[model samples]
Target: MLVDDAVALVPSIPGRRALLGLAGAPAAGKSTLARRLVAGVNDRLGAGTAAYVPMDGFHLSNAQLDRLRLRDRKGAPETFDVDGYVALLGRLRSERTRPVYAPDFDRRLDEPVAAGLVVPAGTALVVTEGNYLADDGPGWGQVRDLLDELWYVETPRRLRERRLLRRHVRGGRTEAEARAFIASSERLNARRVELTRPFCTRVVSPRDP
Candidate 1:
């Protein structure tokens, strides 16, 4: 189904901001889909009517990872600052008149860029995508409650793996390293992410109808 179609269904709250979340496994294309939904809604509504805030911005810095001995598995849920992300989302919903800044993850540097994205005061919808948005753990369950709607982007395993391989290679991994990562960390994380599917408001596959 077209992402634009999904955007059409987002009901506007009278005074509070509406939040739409897209959750999926690594390389499942959640971010790309989230952007499309945001653009589609804005196109039909009005410019500056929607904004995109990604959870990747909450990724722990390499320094922090090194200190925590989690450098080897940087993308794992434990590697992120969930509390910080949750707080930001809370602020976005409560502080409607002020600007809320969100961080963006830089793949080239494998780090987060501070205040890379801004959700303006009048934004009607905020589209946030990430692997753990629907996670049911203590620090994560709040995410599901904050979102007005959550769509889980599901991709075929093979296709998802291929996209991940390419992304890893582009991010400076060799073919062998990429394959090893997929076989180990990424695969494990993907499995965990899929378990949160039942918590989503809807499942959005490439073949969504």
Candidate 2:
């Protein structure tokens, strides 16, 4: 798996902590890949060696989304707290010794839980993944510069869509509702994400070694 290959490269990085960003479209498995990479690195090194921070944690609250009239486009970039997300990454890179708390998104509640995760002091690697990391937009472009390396997870469109449908269903949407969402806004976001692949340090496909 690429997780093993990625873990093999971490020791060569010259830093007390290294940040790795993984970008991919929804359901392309950015979170899954990141979790695997973090686990693999920690297993080889030691516990607390790596932490996973997801950009989904920066999603705006439902009230804020309603105020902005972005409720229907909840997964879109405009629906996230882009500035806050950037600030968190900046803090992660510059601050050491003190514990850095990160938020986590709860699919069941469809909201972000505050201080849901902590990156302990001296943790050697931080793996952050999201759809927008590879994007070249104003706030997003800065994210690339902070990372030691950025990887993109690419999967077949049909397979990705299937995964998304199942995810939505599990998240409380019916199969029809999931398909409709995918056919509508989600697919548009996926297309926009695909445009950023060229900006990534490397691309990882399931077929790759």
Candidate 3:
């Protein structure tokens, strides 16, 4: 989805609770767009006014998932530590002092590292980007309650799948294996995300112009 629309939508926020959310499927470039938006916002507003916190950090540890025998569904909603993520969002929204610690997901290891992230106070806007940020479930609604507005990044399913497949291949999966995983795993999640698209304040479609 278009970055400028997402950016423009952020300022209309009701005020004080200056949090924005970006939601989409995996490899939809949600994180990349979040970075660009932060840079653009900070470029105009000066430093430290904008920050990004992602939901991927709340993934349950591989070990923990292994214990639960849910490791195969890593990207599924139930696979994440949803409660912990909600708590962190609450803290960030309130601008917690004394460094609120958060888990950080290490892609190389495919696990979450505890207390590896700290969000200090004075961050005027917390732009969170994640696949489940717009989910309609009770766990995800907690994030919605803390945000002033939310936007969904809209991309063609074919293009999204192409990008995700390439990303999986680059991340070490064989081409055939990557395609199969995306078809079965990523496709399911994308469909779920599409269902929740209506919850977004706006839908953004990026153009090359």
Best by TM-score: 1
lDDT of 1 at 193: 97
- Residue lDDT tens for model 3, 1-209: 24344345444333343678888887777777777877776776667667777888888887888999986677888888789888888777665344567777777777778877665565566778888987877687677777778878888888888898887787778999888888777888888888888888877753310
In candidate 2, how many Å is residue 173 off? 1.7
Top candidate on lDDT is 1
| Candidate RMSDs in order | 1.7, 1.9, 3.0
Q: Which ten residues in a row have the lowest lDDT in candidate 2?
A: 8-17
Residues 1-209, model 1: lDDT tens digits = 55566566555665678788889999898878777777878878888888889999999999999999998787899999999999998888777788898899999999999999898888878888899999987699889888878888999899999999999999999999999989989999999999999989888874543
Model 2 steric clash total: 0
- Comparing 1 and 2 by TM-score, which wins? 1
Candidate 1 Cα misplacement greater than 4 A, ranges: 1-14, 206-209
Q: lDDT score of model 2?
A: 0.85
Worst 10 residues of 3 by lDDT: 8-17
Clashes of each: 1, 0, 4
